[model samples]
Target: MFTGIIQAVGRVAAIERRGGDARLHIAGLPLADGKLGESIAVSGVCLTAVAFTPDGFVADVSAETLACTTLGDWTVGQAVNLERALAVGDRLGGHIVSGHVDGAGEVLSRRPDGRSERFTLRAPPALARYIAAKGSITVDGVSLTVNTVSGAEFGVNIVPHTLAHTSLDGLRAGGRVNLEVDLLARYLERLLLRADGGGVNLDLLAENGFLKQ
Candidate 1:
């Protein structure tokens, strides 16, 4: 698990494609060696590095990951958002992010807001329902809140601090980004599903204006 707060912006030093997997050696960040097996969120997708080094680490991207994320597009000199796996004592500065990307999304457009910027991303219709104005979503490994939602697209306000700290600053229109809809929303949707055939729709706990609109 990760909080979705990017700790460092690492640069991709090399990528070697072998068979259906790719081995990546990333640089530009101080990394610790993990026990043979460990999960790290690289640009919002949880990946396990089979090996490590002090300068960086190596993670293998399977064909499935390549098809589901922008990892396949990464090349030498590219910047990537990096976050370590959540530890017991870590602060939850960002919202809960499982590092399991739900779907690939695209940047629709961007508008400047002085030191900050506003981005609009178009996600799949199925993922759109999980989003709400002001709800939390993880984009490219950075946890951000939605400013507005419209059909398949949603608006996000990005402060300069975000641009300075994550890979999002380099995003361009039409660029693909890894997206993890709120983990809480998935759980809620399941509860809703179980209620559909039900005894009592406990969702009424939220129905009747109990949950803020």
Candidate 2:
């Protein structure tokens, strides 16, 4: 699990394709602090560290991950958001994020909003249903709140700090972003899918034992 809070900014040092899998070596990172077997969120995708060096680390990107995210668009010198996995005692800074990219979204517009940047995205049709006003959304691995949502489009507020700390600052209009919907919302919606037991109302909260335990 992750909180969408970016810990460091990393750069794409190299991308080596080996058959269907890709070995990515990311530099410009403080990997000295990263343990060899730790889980790291590389632009919102959870990947395990296979090796650690002085500058950064190496993680294998499978064909599925490359097909699912904007990581395929990456090249040398590109900046990316990097965050270590959440620990048991870590504070929930952003929201519960699974680092599972549900689908991809396209950047529709990006511009300055006073001191911050306001970005609008056109999410995939199926993924748009999970978006809500003021709800959480992860774009290119950065957790942001939806300011408004409508017709496959949603807006998010990006502070200057976000721009400086993460790769989101590099995004422009017409760019594509990796999107991951909320994990809890997925389970809740799936429960509703099984709700029509011949109009029988099952205590959803009760069945899941979700209430005060």
State model 2's lDDT. Answer: 0.86
Candidate whose lDDT is highest: 1
Worst 10 residues of 2 by lDDT: 195-204
Per-model CA lDDT versus the true structure: 0.87, 0.86
- Model 1, span 93-139: residue lDDT tens: 99999988988999999989777899999998889999999899999
Clashing residue pairs in candidate 1 (N, C-alpha, C atoms within 3 angstroms): none
The best candidate by TM-score is: 2
- Return the TM-score for candidate 2, rounded to 2 decimals: 0.90
Compute each candidate's TM-score over C-alphas. Answer: 0.89, 0.90
